[model samples]
Target chain A: MGTELVGGRTVLGTLRSDPPLTLRQTGHGTVHLVSTAAGPLGGDRLELAVDVAPHTTLEIASVASTLVLPGNGESLTVVEARVGAGATLRYAPEPTVLAAGCAHRMVVRLVLEEGASVSWREEIVFGRYGERPGTCHSRFDATIGGVPLLRQEFVVGDPAVDGSPAVYGDARCVGSVLLAGPAFGHPGPGNGGRPGNPRGHASVIAEGCAVLPLAGPGTLVSALAPDAATLRARLTWGLGRS
Target chain B: MDAALLLLADSRLPAGGHGHSGGAEEAVRTGAITGPEDLARFLRGRLTTAGLVAAALAAAACELATAPGAAADQAGTRPDEPAAGAAPESAWRELDAEADARTASPAQRNAARTQGRLLLRSARRIWPSPALDTLAGAVPDGAHHPIALGAVSAAAGCSPHDAALAAAYTSITGPATAAVRLLGLDPVVVHRVLAGLVPDLTSVARTAGARAAWERLPAHAAPALDLLAEQHLRTEVRLFVS
Candidate 1:
């Protein structure tokens, strides 16, 4: 999917879709992902590429939460996005459920131009109801002007690691919202000429949530909760504070 | 194992690592870690996630420090030293930034850099390596702890594998010590827990040292750990700084 600025409004340029990963335009600059089939079942591979042209804005969201189911092998989904100069891209997908006996991997690579900005939000629900969660690996890599801003991967579902106090500590839902670019007015690398301020101050807005300013021009809001609703609420609150 | 590696791994190195719990304090306060069993589980999880990241980074930094032209650049400022080029400086900057990228929580990044700065201060006096000076010049505020450990280890004639081992080992030992102090657990039992993790620790270090590229370092994030770090920062009377 691609977007371009035309006549003072963002318009879709290259809208392509493949089975199980269909794209639907709900409004100008807004696209909703509609999954036609269930189960990114084990062994499934899915990919999505997005391009936001200069001065354009694109917001991509999913209509519902995705459920990962077990199959013959592991499943993979990769999303690569590029935002041009002065462009904005908001990719807010619903929560992902890692069901019992399933294994899944999700990778998102986002690159921004000199003046580009982005808001990327992700939430994960470990297993459904009371069942143990299957393995799910999520990697997000973002860079601006060829300089890395954030590169992280979270691997969950292992009972030993996930249930450890150092990792999950009883939280079942986890999420983060990354807001980057000049729009947020965050201090760039070097923290606006302040030395020794490398650990940008983080504001704890809720019980288990915080909004942290990055060393670069970005802010990350992270939260953990016992339930999906509380997790989303904390993330939303933290985003507002950020 | 080099004696210098053991020295670098010593908890009493005056690196200020004693002030941080590596998220164990927060876990204790939250009732996640009540005894030796919980601490053991937590240490194992941490050894795989944060420990792996630090080990890989230390290995990469050590490799860079021993790179052909790097030694020349570190041989003090000479008129002809410019011929060594900007590679070493740029490489240090990139590695430090990569450390920042991998650390999503501001509190955790701050803690790592704080320990890094202090470690550099002490290592410079003990080892007095030109590489340490080069690293200091590159990242004036401070290099991340793993990077500093790697450079200091190189100055002490240790291999990348040794640096990785020290990095991985400290990731657990520090927290284990903190748990003993905070929870009043039996030191013997905590050491027993650490002993049990020896196999996993070696494997993690081996895996981390095997990675040749800085960009491909392990970035396994533990959301609960990130959350705990942030929360620890907000506690008015916390025992650890992060």
Candidate 2:
């Protein structure tokens, strides 16, 4: 379905973190987020909209795994984000877990002027499905400075499709993120195949990392830190300082 | 089999496709794909899903380009009775928009569009179809592969039938050559393998049904390849994305 914010001011920047949330925003505010609590949610939506005037910092967060339920009624919880120019939007949400048979659709849109910076990440687990063993379709679009910088679409699942060698060769876990603005000036990895380069992908940042392969896993976590240098360097390399 | 199709579809055409492995080299590194058969399977899957999808979209564009007097025919149209001419120019507006929506990764999309532009740069000269000229004029940046290929086919005096043939051959030839590079297969052996595919590709090209004519053209699908790409994005150094 659609997300309805529970509480907030006039600006459409309000946040409610319950099973179903609503966030409204009126005038100047850093952010208005509706975060979900612990435990599994029955496929609820945390809808958020940020109005970052001239110069503003709005950081949004999710309480936990926003447990996305297997889809029977086409279960979904979506976030509709819109960003204005000269605004810094740092949206780092907890990874969404698609419990067995669950399906989800997420749409994020950011409209930035010449100098707005946005670091957004989308990660998913196939759930009890053992490395996400089914079909999933996702579409993402972004327009920065009148240029449509990113647009992604994919469908996972089905024999006719799965049987093909083209789409998915074998990896299970997947993640995608986009970086915009001046700080990303020297796009590091340029094309993402160079040696020792890692810029565009924010997930590699040391703030939270588990370098160990996932064949067998162990818990690894760390609070976010202001020391974004290593991250920045990696980003530069990943983006290929071009 | 026509030798021209082999040249037309070769990824090493300096079309910037060398920058992309269609996720082959990338996926293989991630262990998402392995060995010769795996490569074949992956390539086949891409052709049917992502490849097929791209072809369908391109076919529509060709149909549009072929419209009679398509000043009238611009680009991105269906190969309807271009005898009418007006249909293609208008249809392309929507078709190209749809392609923009379907393609996500900005980098990958850029790769595709860039390839299309270069292909058009060369194809327009090699085959100069009015459809190609008009569509290229209407879309200065060059349309996506399907659109460009469609226009190219139209200009070359081939029907939608020819478009399909060209697409299939282009898709297969690239991988076959790559296989030759990766496995060091003899050119004679590669040619034999390629020869075996001709009948099937030609059949598909010539086989047209009413349903095929009216459908929304299939879309590109290659998640394993994409995820492998994501995996590659994380690599410290790599030979290909997958």
Best by TM-score: 1
Q: Which is the leading candidate under lDDT?
A: 1
Off by over 4 Å in 1: A185-200, B68-87
Interface RMSD, prediction 1: 1.8
For candidate 2, give the DockQ.
Answer: 0.26
* CAPRI class assigned to model 1: medium
A75-169 in candidate 2: lDDT tens per residue? 44445555555666666665555555555555555666656677665555445444443345555555555444444544545444455556533
TM-scores of the candidates are 0.93, 0.60
Tens-digit lDDT track for model 1 on B112-190?
9888999899889998877788899888878899999888888888998999999999999999999999989899989
Q: In order, what lDDT does every prediction score? A: 0.84, 0.49
Q: Cα miss at A146, model 2 (Å)?
A: 4.5
The alpha-carbon lDDT assigned to residue B97 of candidate 1 equals: 82
